[model samples]
Target: MYGRMNNNIYILLFCIVFLISIITFTTIRIITDKEREFKKLPNLKAWKYISILIIVAITSFYGVEIYKSATNYGGKLAWFIERLKNERSVKFEHNNIYEFGVEGIFEDINKEHPLPKKLYMASDFDLTFNSDGIITAFDTFVYGKNAHGKEETYLIAYDKKKSQDITIIRNGYANPDYDDDKLVEPLIKTVNAIPVKQTVSKWNESKYGLVYYGKRNWGYNTEGIININEDGKEHNLEKSTSEIIGYTVSIFVPGKEKEVVPARYNLIGDPNWSKANTNPNQKSSKEKQQDLTNSKEQFYLSKEVGYKLNITDKALGSTFYSLSKTIDGGKTWEVINNDPFNGTIGSASGITFLNDKLGFLVAVRPSGTEGELYRTDDGGISFKKVNYTPREVKLDSGQSISPFDSPGMPYEKDGVFNMLVGQGSDGDYNGNSSALYQSKDKGETWEYVKEVKSS
Candidate 1:
């Protein structure tokens, strides 16, 4: 960027120099030409001298101002060029982003950024809030798949003043696609991250912790010159061409943690697909046959999905909300009003485990006019509609420009499901602002709340 600016300066200077040279040469030539004719009218010499003086003065002033501004711009441009070049040399290889703790007030990221951005999943992670309800940290989860088909898990972190300093906690490569089945889809294959408690402590115990750093002005909050290694490239996290990653999702349910990942999402063809293998569509046989086989044998099961006892409410799209049930360590998702809710709660933008019982899902309403949030009571199988927008909105990425319609949901409390929702068919659905909405009675209603934002 700096180099580009420098080139512009040079171009401007060249134009100025060219014009000045032409004028100076033209003025001298005119004087010489006039001299030939002036012998007949000598009084014109005074006019000639006056014209020469005026031209010299004007060009000299122009040259001075141009030189000063150009030199100043050139120096600044040099500094920026140096910084950018250095950034490239020590890029994504550095992973010491967490060195800077929470440093300033968590600003509204939606003001400038496109929600659900490609760099990270827009509104799926939990917001780490301070004791005062102010957001202190930001986080999201994501599934990383390499070209060789090795899947890896990661936790991306954000904080006020230094949100991009992510920390990679638990990482492990996944099994090979023995079937070479790129087309196989799963019932639940992704995860939604929820933030719990976070440390506001400083790096190196050096008085530079979030508490140590005064609020607002964050000049001293140096997370350090960490390299922005995105997708193996040394680039700035803010302006990288990396894929959007929110939270690390796994069908790896807490209770079903021990179960191995199956080959396909649907056991449809698998004879074990029906615990009531005799007839899954039959109502009487469903009750008559006590299928003792693993639930995986009957239907699609994934650690990536939130489980419940019974689900009635649903969201639109390709998911089946009533299919999975998570009983042991997680929340109970017993849902009601299935007739009112249609569609599945699978592969949506954000999903969070609020405590062990309450949960949030960002999905489209049946009418599809606005985005909505769904709540689970027992675990899975049913859901209740909450007055929440479905996804985040964004107007533009440049100049921090955003329209009212572009309200977005970007981040949330740790471990809590956060999402962005608003009106319109956004150019990039993820870029819309996903600022959060708060509801007390299980999303029956909602109210204004702090929005997730960047530094």
Candidate 2:
């Protein structure tokens, strides 16, 4: 809507200029008619009509614009006029950070704002909070047109406790004629210039309290370099290709004001540090191989007692399964059985334990059309495949089909073990509804109850 208004304004100005030019030329020609060539002139009546139409069009466009300004902008005529003069717009975005153990007005420039050709706009607002939800660090950028109408990009970093603001000129064309000594800082930090699409924050249980990570392209042209200005001296550092193509992780720990290190520093030696420091989205060759060869799934029956299924040795599209028990809150694990599914060749979809000695493990084939259900009576020490009894289900379309192609783990509800069996991708009857089966005798045998729709 705003774009259409701007276009209309431009068109209205053009028409007004055209009408003025036509009127001025006609009047001059009539006054200098020395040869009495007024009768040979173009249709003056038509020109007068054209001029009236242009005037009416301009007036109508202004009337519509004024109405819109009154309705949308609370009748702020000066504000609307200023927006027209600058040919720019501003938008606000607010983010809720309560899930990150912090609550504040995390408002910043909307990412949908038009990119400035000469100026750098404030694209993102990043905050680092402590364990108690106290904001310790803030990172953002400031941008606007200078007195000479040139754009300026200033990277800003604020320390909450120190109450100091660190600003750095990002773009090469930024004016440095002002007092640079006051802007010089002992601690210079790099900030993201591009708009951040997604941000992930993790609680570092080691040294750092909370770590905020932001993902964006850090190529040579996009990477933000910390250009420190000391004693009114500014330096523009060039980006190198060796810079890792990964996300930037900001580590902020309370009470360590001066120890804010770069994301490249693996101070905590987290296992995922190497992966995130390299390429976060892409997995390495070794990691991919490991993913294909090995997998683990855990199900906790209680706060301290849990069971884990480890599928390993992927050969010939099959893998060996083992069940491990952890009684002391995952501190130690004990492998009870080497082969729970009697050497089944499928992926373990789920593992559920009703008690310490009774559990079920489900293994689904790669096609997901069929699966093997194993039940253990002696706490995963031994296992035997349980064949589920199939029942015909009548669909709304009057078609009867067995919908128990893939069986899920049994969950105890209302003193009964209930399980849902899906029809997999091959079945599309009744919106791919699952057949709910209930076991009355502790999952010893199952009976068909009813059809359950996939929500």
Candidate 3:
């Protein structure tokens, strides 16, 4: 029945077009013959009305042809015009992983960092934080096909302290029905840039914004960003779908979550993966991908592009894992540093940030038999110990994994373990899982406080 109906529609359209083509050709031939044959006068004397109809028909065909010709000409003209009119857009010269992670945006620090002019943050698939501090905005993944399904990822954020949901984008992990053995592709889908609820205590100042990275569906990373603003996310389990994946940054207007950017001006990042979590290796399974991570190296997200930069198995004996960045307002992104982690960090369950330029990323480095907290001073270029903090976080050897991993190993080591330095009413960052901190002389010393918090 369906096939017959489709065939009927095709036949009807074909007949109408065929008839039009034949009539137009025949009329042109008749007009040409008349003109050649001693001025037949187009049979005007016999029927002026007929001649008029012929004129209308001929003109209509000619009109369409002329319009098509003009359209093509205009397109050609446009191509040349653009070449002449626009100067090359300002080019952001590429830099290395160390260059990308440098601390240069700290010129604007003041005694009291005023209410943020703008803010944004992204987290992993399963959320760990309750949206505290500058971890400004996020949305809970509502299951049951409303937007996100069982393996769906939802991106939520706010410009300010309001309930407005500035959805960036969403994507599914993998299809259970396919049995592809593919663990979600590691691109934007793999690393959930979803911010943990906890933040760092005080000590330093620098540029600020969220760091979001993704893995899994590398091609459809743009679709994730699209999901942030629109309703009805993509569902592979069901049929019929539309989506685009990529990354962008937004200025959360004071007192509002409204995204205020010039239309079509999505400040997209390096055109590597579609979105951050787009898995480059869809053909491989989850276990195979994990098997590759056992070896270690130091990974860095430079503006660099090449086979060497894109895929890194290890760095410094530590697997260079995933990393995130918030260049635009929308989707979170993976640092081109796209390798495993340089060291073991997943055991340290929390993350915090001050800004884009300078922030502290804390993680657990297994010291002998136990895990110790390590701090990254400049994003991840190099890490150091917290001034007064202990060398390592000792854990019981009987436990198979570190403390944070006991919670189902939700977060990956490299990007997940982090901390921030901020001040509260009491003024001190006193090693609280979540709280405010104070530094008397610009990070040379510090203290922690539980009163007011710093995000």
Candidate 4:
């Protein structure tokens, strides 16, 4: 598809260049000819008329050609955009793992799409817990054969304990035999199961919106953003799905939970508000960088100074990771510096500030060599590299791994900082089985402690 588009662009460029060359040649000849020679030329009026006619003919021909080309190209582009903007209905031949861990199984069903007596495979498929580990909501991925035994995937939301269903999504894939209840058109936007971290954790409680993308579908292919609560309660956000493509969205913060920010890639209430178009086909590199700069931001509030820090991560490029300060609770932000963090961040990164002037930043090093750790004493204005012995530990599977391979959030208590670094047992090598290390002197020295298990 891209190759064809490139060919079209090449053709258009060639035609433009050819027209410009012809016009330039004609003008040069007209200007260079001597007045006597030019005037005395036989059939000069005929030549002038002929030239005008030829130019008009050629212009008209190319205009029509260009118009046809553009129309066809525009039609194809619009089709592609539409395909992207909507949920794609697909057929399932066998059991397959679709995007967002959505598994489709060709199975048997009765005359209606009734609740399964038992899940084909079970164990917390959709139940999301609260901070206290209590079930808050369950976004069930209901898949079964309909009246005709055609396989279909359905979505339904339920409150805690799965006692009451609140919403149902009818994707029109297979009309499930409804029992008196009118089947409202289900919003087919794919969503990953919202983890308890986003639902109940304090770090994510103050977010503005929700952003989710599947691993198989990179970028905006399988991404969704909405202003609905975890239980599918809509807040009138009315945002188009396309607008959430490149945004790193989160939920609304406390006291602002009811606020609905429009579709924007950056912070909603930012003083320097800029809506970035994340469409790869329509956006330039500079625009993408700006959008990324606004997407991944970390906020920290100091108890003593009452100051707030916002660290923006512009990853996957050479753009600097900026540090911004907000004196008044995120109403406005001023960029303090973008140079403090260099080669200290990767796609998966995190930042933590102990106070107004003390903070730690860690990121996976470029090319996955090791995790880089940085510390800021004077409120993130400047950072100094802190050295530690990267743990080389063995898991139960007898696989050798490095702690720096999978860096995680640092836990600090009584000036004793425990860096919970673990080597991922999974294929991705993310630190799943973690080990805790003590760094009493603020990341200067480290001592290995017992292995820590992720709760």
Q: Give the TM-score of each candidate.
A: 0.25, 0.36, 0.22, 0.34
By TM-score rank, best first, the candidates go 2, 4, 1, 3
Poorly placed runs, candidate 3 (over 4 Å)? 1-326, 329-348, 365-380, 389-438, 441-444, 448-455
lDDT of 4 by residue, 346-431 (tens): 32255677777877766553223345567788888888876666667676899986654455566688868888765532323443
Overall lDDT per candidate, in order of appearance: 0.33, 0.51, 0.29, 0.43
Candidate 1 vs candidate 4: the lDDT winner is 4
- The 10-residue segment with the lowest total lDDT in model 3: 101-110
Clashing pairs in 2: none
Which consecutive 10 residues in model 1 have the weakest lDDT in total?
Answer: 211-220
Output the TM-score of candidate 4: 0.34
Residue 374, candidate 2: Cα error in Å is 1.5
The TM-score of candidate 1 is 0.25
The local distance difference test score of model 3 is: 0.29
In candidate 2 the C-alpha lDDT for residue 434 amounts to 89
Q: Over the stretch 1-455, how does candidate 2's per-residue lDDT look in tens digits?
A: 33356656987789799889979987887788835656664556887899799889977987887677644223456334533533222221122232322212212322433223333322234456444434555554335555667655444344557543222323311212232111211111122221111211342422233332322223333223322222222233354433233223343444453444233211112222222224445656754432222212567777568887764343222345677887865546788888787876545767888888898888765334667677888988998787778878676789887767778888898999898988754667778888888998888888889889889
When 1 and 3 are scored with lDDT, the better candidate is 1
Give the candidate number with the greatest TM-score.
2
Q: Residue by residue across 1-455, what tens digits does model 3's lDDT show? A: 22234636987789799889979986887777855644656654677787698889977975675455443123333333433432121111211111221111111111122112221111222111112222333222111132222232222222335432232223311111221121122222212221111111121222123332222222223321322222212222121132233343221222222333111112233344233323444434643433222111111222221111122221111122444443432233445333223445222323333333333333322111222233445554444544433212243554332121111011223333222332211222233223233454334344543333323
Question: How many residue pairs clash per model?
Answer: 83, 0, 109, 4
lDDT of 1 by residue, 1-455 (tens): 22345657987889799899989986787688976644656777798899899899978976675555444223344334433432211111222213211212111322322122112121133333333334444443333344555443333344556443333322311111222111111111110011111222211122111111000111111121112111222211233222111112121112332343211111222222212223334434433222211121121123323333222221111123333344422223333334323553222323444444555555432222334455666543456655433333343563332322322332345533334445433323334334455555544555556554432
